[model samples]
Target chain A: MIVAEQKPLDEIRDLIADAGKVLVVGCGTCVTVCFAGGEKEAGILATSLRMASKLNGNAQDVTHLTVQRQCEWEYLDPIEEQIRQAEVVVSLGCGVGVQALAEHFPQAWVVPGLNTSFMGLPTEQGVWEERCAACGSCILGLTGGICPIARCAKQLLNGPCGGSQDGVCEVNAETPCAWQLIYDRLKAHDRLDLLMEIQPPKDWSTSRDGGPRRITREDLRLVAEQVE
Target chain B: MSAADQVPLQIVAYCCHYCAYAAADLAGVLRLRYPGEPKIVELPCTGRLDVLEVLHAFEHGADGVMVAGCLEGDCHFQVGNLNARRRVAMVKDLLNQIGLEPERIEMFNMSSAMASQFAAAAEEMTARVRTLGPNPLREESVS
Candidate 1:
């Protein structure tokens, strides 16, 4: 899931400094799970902005509403009236949600309330760790279900990268060396020979190097088009 | 007395049902006097405390807010107080960002048997908030 954290209150306040009416829009998907831009967070931020603005001798007309999924147009459509009413809309969503709101409502001024951090999961209570880079490819099968692209400090395909010490990355002592984890898991499964295969250099064309990626699923789209 | 002292600060205390609330009740039974300003909001456990609750208290013109729970390593639910403490810390950072003194909110740990500690926690928070004066946003919220 996409994980994000709220921007500092002061920075958020500055985003709507000129607006008389502000609306905080929350997304009910990935961000909600991470406790960043969920329904409760939207209300909290709206209240904070209200109180902060009042304390600073400004307008206090702030409100909040949450959409089922801010990345989808149908979910956002229901809140168009609310979006239209505000001079500024602060989206407590991931970067995608923020852009979706802006693109969906061309007239509404939208700003991000969260710093879109990464595609990750909560490893434990109140802790989130990055797990995927969406490199437009998948190589977990070759690396004991762990992607070196996301976990390795250097994204080395064939690695333990001399910096790996005692199964921990030298870049951040707290982080487990991805290559070490891969090696250990493979050895346990008696598939250590996979590592000796001398993998080819990763194809950069499938990742960010390929620029913004898109997929044309003709079957799904045709079904939707037919339903329309 | 100075005019600021007469501001009648309003403080909110979120007491856990298993410990702090019972201790507060015991304090009442013992006839131990504490500050009257702190309005208690009892929770099943301090672990149920959310960041928004603290923020709401401040937004509603609470001069100060406190969360009282079982002593560290002695929570009835094992780690409710610990969870509350971390949430309270986050609230402090939020308060700081909002330009309010972080001292306006605090977390206290005590067992249900500690009635005296409960009263003391109230008095401590009262004294601290009184020194800071009423929440600056109080007048703003009112008007």
Candidate 2:
């Protein structure tokens, strides 16, 4: 799931400073699971903003709304009236949701209330760590399922670097060396020979380096065209 | 009468049913006197308390809010009290951030039989809130 953290209260207050009416929008999917831009968080943020504004003597009419998924058009359509009423829209969604809102309501000024952090999963209660870099490449088959792009301090394709100390990355003592984890897992599976195979440099075209990525399904597109 | 004298400080206490709530009831049976300004809201567990609820209390005129739960490791629902304690700390930090006194909110722990402790907590919270004066929002509403 996509993980995010809310921007500081003061920063959020400043973003919607000039607006008389503000709408705080929350996404119910990825950001909800990570406890960032969920319905509950949206309400708390709205209340906090109101209190902060009141204290600053620039009281604002803050409204709170949560959609199932802000990235989709249909889900956002229901709150069109509220969005129209608000002078500024504060999106408590991930980066994609913020963009979706902006695209859907070009007339309305949309601002992000959260700093979209990473694509990851909760390791434990209240703890989330990045797992997939979404490099548009699949190399997990050769490396025991651990992602070097996301986990390793240096995205080493082959083996542990000289900076790996006692299975910990030298960049930060708290971080476990990704290559070491791959090595241990491969040894347990009796596939240590996989590490001996030298991996070539990863192709950058599939990643963000090329440009904004797009996935087009020709079959789905053709079906939609026929229906139209 | 001044504003403070005219409106008694409003304190909201969210008590867990198994322990803190029972302790308050026991205190009443024992005829122990505590501040009457606090209105008790009983909950299955303090873990059910959300940050919004505490903020709402203050937003709606609560000068102080207290969350009382089972002592550590003695929660009827295992870690409910522990989670509530962490949430209380978070709310306190938020209160401070918003320019409100952190003392306006607190968390306390007690067993079901601790009637004296419950009364003491009530007295302690009431005194703290009284010293802090009414919630600034109340002043805003009055003027």
Candidate 3:
């Protein structure tokens, strides 16, 4: 899920200070699952903003709306009229959702209310550790499901870097040595031999290195693009 | 605005049913004293306590908040307490960004057997909040 943390209240307050009408948009995808930017968050943000505005003696009109998935066009279609009416939009979604909203509504000033964090899973309840870097590769099979790309301090593909000590990353004692975790998992499975297989350096081309990328499937070809 | 006059801190306490909430109930049964100021919000599991709920509490009027859950691996739901720990950390970061004292929010992991622990936590959180005073959001209502 696209994990996002809320921006500072002062920053947010500043963003809408001059605006007369503000719309808080929430996404119902990765952010919703993380409880960062979702329907509930949108409502809470709207309430907080309203309260802040009231405190400042600058009462402003605020609206809250949540789409099924802000990253997708169809999901955002329902809120088009409302989106157009607002002078500014504060997206409580991930970076993608904010960008998608920006693209859809070029005339409105779009503001991001969240700082999109790394892609991760709820490792334990509220704790979400980065698990995938989306480096355009999958090596989980060799490392017992742990992605070194995200966990390893250096994203080491071959093995533990010199920074690892006593099975912990030097960067932070709380963080476990990703390579050590891999080694232990491999040893438990009696597949220690797989560690000897040298992994090729990750191909950066497939990742976010070269601007935005696209993946098209034959079955999912766009008919609109074909006509254009 | 006098230093002698402390702000009436608003605190939200999320009590897990099986552990923290049960412990709180036990405190009541024993007549164990704890702070009454912090509004208690009971939940089936701390895992069910969303970050937005915490934010909402702060937005409404909470000066500080804490989530009390079962000890690790002791949750009635097996992992709810653990999830609460992780969620609280993220919320702490969010709170920090929002100019609120991150220390205002915290999480405590304990079992039902720790009724004293629960009371102590409540007292401690209330004291911490007293030090922090009421949230700035409550200023409008105050004056």
lDDT (C-alpha) at residue A127 in model 2: 95
Q: For model 1, how does the per-residue alpha-carbon lDDT over B4-41 read when each residue is reduced to its tens digit? A: 67767788999999999999999999999998988999
lDDT of 1 at B20: 93
Model 3 lDDT tens row, A51-155:
567556676798899998988888888898999999889999899999999998888789999999988888886788888888776889989988898899898
Task: Report the C-alpha lDDT of model 1 over A1-228, residue by residue, as the tens digit.
Answer: 999999989899889999999999999999999999999999889988988898788846999999989999999998999999999999999999999999999999999999999998888988999999999879998998999999998999986889999999999989999999999999999999889888789998999999889999776774534553
DockQ for each of the predicted structures, in order?
0.74, 0.72, 0.25
Model 2 lDDT tens row, A157-182: 98889999999999999899999999
lDDT (C-alpha) at residue A3 in model 1: 93
lDDT of 1 at B51: 87
Q: Once model 3 is optimally superposed onto the true structure by TM-score, how far is the C-alpha of residue A59 displaced, in angstroms?
A: 2.0
Per-candidate TM equals 0.94, 0.95, 0.67
> What does candidate 2's lDDT look like per residue over B1-143, in tens digits?
65655567789999999999999999999999998978999999998988998998887779999999999999999999999999999998878767789999999999999999999999999988888888877644433
Query: Which pairs of residues clash in candidate 2, taking residues 3 or more apart in a chain or in different chains?
Result: none
- Please rank every candidate by DockQ, starting with the best: 1, 2, 3
- In angstroms, give how far residue A93 of model 3 lies from its true place: 0.7
Off by over 4 Å in 1: A223-228, B140-143
Give the total clashing residue pairs for model 1. Answer: 0
The per-residue C-alpha lDDT of model 1 at residue A228 equals: 35
lDDT for B74 (candidate 3): 83
